[model samples]
Target: MTEQTTGRLKVRLVDGLLILIMAVLAGCGLIYEYLLSHYAGRVLGAVEHAIFATIGIMIVAMGFGAFAARKIKDAFSGFAWLELYICFIGASSILFIAAAIGFTFHLPQLISDTFNLPADVLPRGGWVEQLHQIARYLPYVSAACLGFFIGIEIPLIARVREALYQKHLTHNAGTVYGADYIGAGIGAALWIGWMMSLDINQAAVITASTNLLIGFLILLLFWQKIRWRLLLTACQLLMLAFVIVLSAYGQNWMNSFTDMLYRDQVVLQQQTQYQQIVLTERNLQLNNNPTQTSVLQLYLNGRLQFSSMDERIYHEMLIHPVMASAPKHDSVLLIGGGDGLALREIFKWPVHSVDMVELDPMMISLFKQPRQFLPIRLAKQVIELNANSLSDERLNLMYADAFNQVDQLVAQGRIYDVIVVDLPDPNHPDLNKLYTNHFYTRLQQLLNADGVLVVQSTSPYHAQDAFIAIGKTIADANFSAVEQYHQNVPSFGQWGWSVAVKQGLPVSERLKHSLAAQTMPVIKTQWLTWPIVLASFNFPQGFYKNYVNIKVNRLGSQQLFNYHDQAWRKQQGMVNLNSNQQISP
Candidate 1:
C-alpha cells in the first residue's frame, strides 16, 4: 500500500474506535445516574421525590461538567481519568451514602457518650439534628457529582476524536453526539430489560466494570500516543480487581449498612423488580431468660406491613367480619395478601375454593421458602401462623396485578361469594387506581348476586378524609350497602375496614341483627368476636358524622391519593410538633 493510503486507513480506524468509546461511555454514564437515584429512593422515604430530585440535580450538573470540560489541556488523558473517576464513584456511591447515613444516626449517641450528657437533655436544635439535616442532602450532592463527571465524558470524547482525525474529520460534533445518544438509548434498554433484575449493588458493580473496560480499551487503542501508558494500565487493572471483589461481597455490606437504619435486626433483605422487601426481627428477652420472645416484622419500601406480635389482630379484623356476614362463603377472592395470613383466616370456613391475586411473586416466595438466616423456618412459621392455609388443595394463587386479574375473572364469567381487598394503602399515585370507583365497580361485578366485598381502608382516626373517601367511593360504585368499621391493632393503631353487599341491605343493620341473634364464627379467632365486631361499627359521637367535604375517589381524579397524602402529612406534623414540644425548655 502507498504511504498516503496507510495514513488514511489509520485515521479511519482511530475514528471508529473513538466513536465506539463514546457509545460505551454514554451507556455507563446513564446507568450511574440511575443507580444513585434508585439507591437514594430506597434509603430515603418519598421515593418519587427522591428519584425526581436526584435525576434533576444530575442532569443540571451534567451541563456544568460539559461546560467545564473546555478547560482540558489533553483530551486523551482527561477522558481516561474521567472514566476512572466515574468507575470509582459509581461503584462506591451507594456504599458512601449508606455509611454517611449510618454515621449521622450514630453521631448523637457518640456525642452524648463523649460529654456524658443525659440522653433526655440533648438540645432540641443540636448537632445531632444538624447532622440529620446534612445527611438528607447527601444523596443530592452525590448525584450532582456523578452527573458532573458523566457530563464531561461526552465533551472529552468529542475533543479526543477531533485530535485523532485532525483535519480528516468533518462534523465531529454530529458523530460524537449521535454516538452518545445511541449509547444512552442502549443503556436505558439494558437497565430496564436486564440490569433491574439484579440486586442494586450488583447492578452498580456491573456498570462500573463497563466503565473500567472503556478506559482500558481507550488506553490500548491510543497507547502509542498516550503519556504514562504503563501507570494508567496498572490503575485500570487495579480498579477492575476492586470491582470484581465488590460484586462478590457488596450485598452483605449493603445488608449490614441497612440493618443500622432500622430499629430491629434485618433478617432478610431482597431487591425485587417492583420494590425493596425487608424483614426485621426483634427478640425481647424476658427477665434475661435464654428463651426470648421474637417479633418478626415485614416492611415493603420501608413501610411496616405487619409485626408478628400484633398481626393476628389486624388479620382477624380484616377477614372475619365479611366472612361471617356473607350469605354463602362457598367461593372467595383475595387481592394482595401474599403473606397468607388472610388466607389462613378464610380457610376457617369450608369454602369450596379461594382465588388470590398478588403482584410480587418474590414476596410469596420469601414467606413460603425456607431460609437459613431466619431464626425459625419461614414456611413452618407461616403454616403455624396461617393454619396451613396456603397449602390447601382448594387455594389457587395468581401472580398478577389485581386490577387486570379482576377484568380477566369477569371475562371468564367467574364470580365469588366474597371478595377481600387486602392491598396496601393508596399511599402512592400508582395505587390510586386500585382504590378508584372504577376498580371498585369492576370488583362489584365479580361478586355473586348476594356476594359481599370488604376492603381494608386506612385508619379512620389517622386518615379520616381518606377513610371517608374510600367508603364514599365504594358506595358510589353502586353497591347496595356500604359500612365502615375500625379496630385497634397495636401494630397499626386504629385500623379500618369497609364492607359492601350487593343486595342493597344496610351492612350496619345486618351486622347489628346478626350480633343480636348471637351469631358466632365457625372458625375461632384470636381477637374478633360478635360483640367486638358490633363495637367496631360504632365510632365516637360525630367522629364521621360531619365529614361531608370528602371527595369521591374516581379513576381519573384519584382524590384518595390526595386525601391520603394530606392526612399522613397532617399526622406527621402533629407528631413532629409534639416531639418538639416535648424537648422544649
Candidate 2:
C-alpha cells in the first residue's frame, strides 16, 4: 500500500473507534444519572420530587461540565481521566450514600456509646440531625459529579476525532451529539427492559465496567501518541478489578448498610422493576422470656406498608366498612393490596368471586412464594398474616396498573358489589392519578347499583388536607354520599378511610341500618366489631369543620399531591420542633 493510503486508513480506524466509544460512554452516562435519581427516591421517601430534582440538578451540572471541557488542551488524556472518575463515582455512589445515611441513622447510638450517656439524654437537635440534613444532599452531589464527567466526554471525544482527522470535520457536532442522544435512548431501554431487574448495585457495577472498558480502549487506540501509557493502563486495570469485586459482594454490603438505616434487621431486600422491596424483622421478648414475638414489616420504596403486630387493625378497617354496608358481598374488587391482607379480610365473607389488581408482580410473588433464606418464622409470619389468601380458588388476580385496569373493566361491562381501594397514599405524582376524580369516576361506573366503595385515605391527623381532599374528590365522582372515618393503629397513628355509596343513598343510614340488622359479624375480626364500625363514622364535632374550601383532587391539578406533601412536611416540622422543645434546658 502507498504511504498516503496507509495514513488515511489509520485515521479512519481511529475515528471509528472514537465514535464507538462516544456511543457506549453516552449510554453509561445516562444510566448513571438514572441510578442516582432512583436511589435518591428510594432513600429519601419522596419519589416524585427526588427524581425531578436529581435530574434537574444533573442537567445543569452537565452544562457546567461542557463549559469546563473547553479548558482541556489534551482531549485524549482528559477523556480517559473523565472515564476513570465517572466509573469510580458512578459505581460507588449508591454505596457511599447508603453508608452516609446509615451512619447518620446510628449517630445517636454511637454518641451514646462513645460518651457513656443515656440514649434518652442525647441532644436531639445536635450532630445527628445535622448529619441527616447532610445525608439528604448526597444523591444530588453524586449526580452533579457524574454529570460533570459525562458532560466533558462528548466534547473531548469530538476534539480527539478532529485531531485524528487532521482537518476540521464538517458535521462534527451533529455526529457527536447524534451518537450521544441515540445511545441514551438505548440506555433507557436497557434500564427498563433488563438492568432494573437486577439488584441496583449490580446494575451500577455493570455500567462502571463498561466505562472502564471504554477508557482502556481509548488508551490502547492512541498508545503511540498518549503520555504515561503504562500508568494509565494500570490505573484502568485496577479500577476494573475493583468493580468486579464489588459486583460479587455488592448486595451483602448494601444489605448491611441498609440494615443500619432501619431499627430492625433487613431480612430480605429486592429491587423490582417498579420499586425497592425490603422486609425487616424485629424480635421482642416479653418479661425477658426465651419465647420471642417476631414482627415482620414490609416497606416499599422505604415507606412502611404494614407491620405484623397491628396490620389487622388497618386491614379490617379497610375491608369491613364497605363490605358490611354493601347490599351484597358476593362479588368484590380490590385495588393495590398485593400483600393479600385485604384479600384475607374479603375471604371471610361468602364471596363467590374476587378480583385483585396490583401493580407489582414481585410484591405478589414475595407473599405467594416465601423465600427460604428469610427467617422461617418471619416468612411464615407474612403467610399467616395474609392467611395464604392468594391461594384461594375464587380470586382473579391481575397484575397491572389499577387505573388502566379499572378503565378496561368498565369497557368489559364488569361491575362489583363492593370496591375496596387499598392503595398506598398519593405520595408520588404517578399515584396521584389513582386518587383523582378521573379514576374515582371510572370506578363509580364499575360499581353495582347498590354498591359501596371505600378508599384508604392517608392519616386524618397528620395529612388532614389530603384526607379531606380524598373524600371531596370521591363525592365529586358523583357518589350519592361520602363519609370519612379513622382508626388509631399503633403502627400508623390516626389513619383514615373514605367510604362512598350510590347517589341519593345515605351511607350513614345504610351503615346504621346494616349494623342494627346484623347482631354479629358474618366473620370474626380481631379489632373490628359492629359497635366499632358504628363509632368509626362518628368523629368529634368540628374535626373537619376547619377544612373548608379544600379543593377536590383533579387529574389536571393534582391537588392531593400538593396537600399530601405540605401536610407531611408540616407534620415532620412539628415532630422536629417537639423534639427540640423536649431536649431544651
Candidate 3:
C-alpha cells in the first residue's frame, strides 16, 4: 500500500472510534438522568414533581457543563476524566440520596431516643426541618453533578477528534451530535422497555459499567496523547471492581436504607412498571412474645394503601354501602381495588359476576397467586389476608388503565348494578384525570338507572377541599343524588367516600329500603353495621356546603391535584396557609 493510503486509513479508524465512544456515552448519560429522577420520585412522595423537577435541573446543569468544558486545555485527558467522574457519581447517586432522606426521616426519632423525650415532646420546625428539606433535595444536587459531567463530553470529544486529525473539521460538531442524538433515542427505548422494571441499583450499576468500559477503550486508543495513562487504567479497574460489587449487593443495601424510612419491618419491596410496592409487618408484643395477629401494611409509591389491622373497616365501608343500596347485586364493576380486600367484601353478597379493572398486574399477581420470589411466610399472610378472593372463578380481571377502560366499557354499552372506585389519592396529574368530571361522566354511562357508584375520596379532615371537589365533580357529571361520608381508619386518619345514585332514591334511602326488606339473608361484616352505614352518611353540619368558588376538576385543569398537594403540604407544615384560601366552609 502507498504511504498516503495507510495514513488516511489510520485517521479514519481513529475518527470512527471517537464517534462510537460518543454514542455509547450519550446512552449512559440518558440512563443516569432516568435513574436519578425515578429514585427521587419514589422517595420524595411527589412523583410528578420529583421526576420533572430533577430532569429540568439536570438539563440546565448540562448547559452549564458544556460552557465550562472550554476551560480544559487537554481534550484527551479531559474527556477520559469526565467519564470516570460520571461513572462513579451515577453508580452511587441513588444510594447517597436514599441515605440522606432516610437519615432525615429517622432524625426526630433519634433525638427522642437520645434525650428520653415523650412522643409529642420532640423538636419541630428548626434545624430538624431544615435538614429534612435539604435531604429531600439531594436528588437534584446529584443530578446537577452528574449532568455537568455528561455535558463536558461533546465538546471534549470534538476537540479530541480535531487533535487526532491535525485539523479542524467543519462538520465535527454536527457529526458528534448526530451520534449523540441517536444514542439518546436508544437509551430512552431501553429505559421504557426493560430497565425501568429492573432493580434500581442494578440499573445504575449497568449504566455506570458501560461508562467505565468506554473510558478504558479511550485509554487504550489514545495512550500517547493522554496524561497519567497508568493511573487512569488503575482507576478504571478499581471502578470496574466497585461496580461488580454493587451489582451483587447493592439491592440489599438499598433495601436497608429504605427500611429506615418505615416504622415497621419491611419484608418485601419490589419496583414494578407503574409504582413501587412495599409490604411491611408490625408485630404486637405480648410480654415480649410476638402475637399471631401481626399487622401487614401495603404502601404504593411511599403512600400507605392499607393496614391489615384496620383494612376491614376500609374495605367494608368501600364495598357494602353501594352493594346494599343497589337494587340488584348480580353484576358489578370495580376499579382500582387491586388488593382484593374489596372483592372479599363484594363476594359476601350474592353477586353473580364481577369485572375488575386494575392498572398494575403485578399488584394483582402478588395477592392472587403464590410466587417463589416472596418469602414463604409473607406469601401466606398476603394470600390469606384477602381470603384468596382474587383466585375465585367469578372474577373477570382486566389489566388496563381505568381511564381508558371506562371509555371502552361505555363504547361497548356495558351496564353494572354497582361500580366502586377504590383508587389512590390525586397526588399526580395522571391520577387527577381519573377524578375529573369527564371521567365520572364516562363511568356514569356504565351504570344502570338504579345502580350506585361509590368513589374513595381523600380525607375529609386533612384534605377537605379536595374531598369536596371530588363530590362536586361527580355531581357535575349529572348524577341524581350525591352524598359524602367519612370514617376513621387508624392507619389513615379520617378517610372519606362519596356515593352517587343514578336515579330514583338516594344512597341513604335505598340502603334503608334494603334493610327493611327481610327476604334476603343479612350480610355480616367485621366493621360495618346497618346503623353505622346509615350514620356514615351524616357528616358535621356545613361540611359539604362549600361557600368559596371551588371549581370542578375538568379534564385539562388540574385543580384537584393542586388542592390535594396544598392541603397535604399544609398538614406537613411545608407550606404557610394564605388567609384567602379556606378549604372548609
Query: How does each model score on TM-score?
Result: 0.91, 0.95, 0.93
For candidate 3, the C-alpha RMSD (Å) to the true structure equals 3.6
lDDT of each: 0.80, 0.83, 0.86
- Using lDDT as the measure, name the better of candidate 1 and candidate 2: 2
Against the hidden true structure, what lDDT does model 1 obtain?
Answer: 0.80
Ranking by lDDT: 3, 2, 1
lDDT of 2 at 416: 94
Candidate 2 per-residue lDDT, tens place, 1-585, comes to: 999999999888878777777778888888888888888877665667888899988889999999999998888888877888988998898988888887776777777798999866864466668777688679999998888878888788889988888789999999999888888988999998999888888999999989888888888877876777788888888898889888888778988988887778788888888887888888787887755767888888777889888899989998887787777888899998888899999999889999999999988888877855466766676788899998899999999999899989999999899999998888888889999999999999999889999999988877888889999999999898899888888877788899999754666677677666764357789988767877877777787886678999999797999998887667656563112111000
Q: Considering every candidate listed, which one attains the maximal TM-score? A: 2
Q: Write the per-residue lDDT of candidate 1 for residues 306-365, one digit (tens) a residue.
A: 888889888888888888788789999999888788898888887999999989988777
Cα deviation of 430 in candidate 2 (Å)? 1.1
The alpha-carbon lDDT assigned to residue 349 of candidate 3 equals 90
Which portions of model 3 show Cα errors greater than 4 Å? 111-125, 285-291, 370-373, 516-521, 545-548, 574-585
